[model samples]
Target: MKKLSLLILSLGVLFSCQSASSKTEPENNPEIKMEENKTMQQDVTKKKNRIVVFETTMGKIKAELFEDKAPITTNNFITLTEKGYYNNLIFHRVIPNFMIQGGCPEGTGRGGPGYAIKDEFGPGLKHDKAGILSMANAGPNTGGSQFFITTVPTPWLDGKHAIFGQVIEGLDVVLKISEVERNKMDRPLKDVIMTKVYIVNE
Candidate 1:
């Protein structure tokens, strides 16, 4: 009887230690730790990005500004939108299967908000797909209120332009605008105006 009691006590301690070890194994696992870190980064990115809605004459377009990736360019765009600077602005330049350029208050692609901002480029940001929102600049570091939304991947403009945001909804509307009739300068034959622009903190 004494021997049996001692054996039972030993087994209990062994099982208890095994259970404790298993509980802590995941906390020490490198793979699990990496996954946890990745999830944290994703949450941070979600909090940083801002949603913007563009109510154009053609249709409504929704976009997400990559504030973390392009702080300067995103700030400039958000500031302008908050100030109603994009209201009534026309998509001055349009090309089928290419891009639609706008945000020139002058409606002639020669105006700005009385200032220019430095260019921002990142490895993760690129004109790799349609609906990419990028700064329209004449040369390096000349970005201002002018911007464009690509209707197709424009890899050539990757480092040349600052990618600030991407259209999440209303891409068909962008495609429609791109197919509109334009003149010699690629300006839309009839105005495709941005009736209203707003920002959502989420």
Candidate 2:
């Protein structure tokens, strides 16, 4: 009986040591570990989202384009940008330290892409600061080629418009444009033309 009990304890200890050894072994194959990590990181980054680069005549302006959250607004913007629709349009309205409106075919802040788009608004975005670029519209569900860049917070415009992107560079140029002399309605004394529009990889 004593011999049997000792043998059982030895077997239990051996099994326990084997389990502990297995616990110490690495599950991942070291040869492919780095490659797998890189692939996963890329997948996550691809879904992490990116912004659009608006190479303007004034300067290069980077904008965080909204796509996942604002599909319609983003699609419209992408369509226009891809087609070079914004080239040569002037920022017709310049309210100093307030907002700069454009996207008018006539560069008069009264034109569009000959069609309107539905408005998409929600949380996590606001017009409560400067350098914010948003879609310009006549009324609800009437947004099109028109868009504006804010120079100051316009809280009143929030929830009533769709913010497609925001300036990430050359805001000083925006400020300079804002300082342009204005007419009675705060429109620019002269046109702040966007001579060209091109894309850059984000």
* Top-TM-score candidate index: 2
Candidate 2, residues 2-103, lDDT tens digits: the string is 999999999999999999999999897886998989999988777644566655456666677766678788888778877989888888887776877777
| lDDT for model 1 | 0.92
| Pairs in steric clash, model 1 | none
Each candidate structure's TM-score, on Cα atoms with residue i matched to residue i, is 0.77, 0.78
Q: State the weakest 10-residue window (summed lDDT) of model 2.
A: 48-57
Q: Give the clashing residue pairs of candidate 2, or none.
A: none
Which parts of model 1 have CA positions greater than 4 angstroms off? 1-46
| Candidate achieving the largest lDDT | 1
Error of 2 at 85 (Å): 0.6
Candidate 1 contains a number of clashing pairs equal to 0
Error (Å) of candidate 2 at residue 169 is 1.1
Ten-residue segment with the worst summed lDDT in candidate 1?
23-32
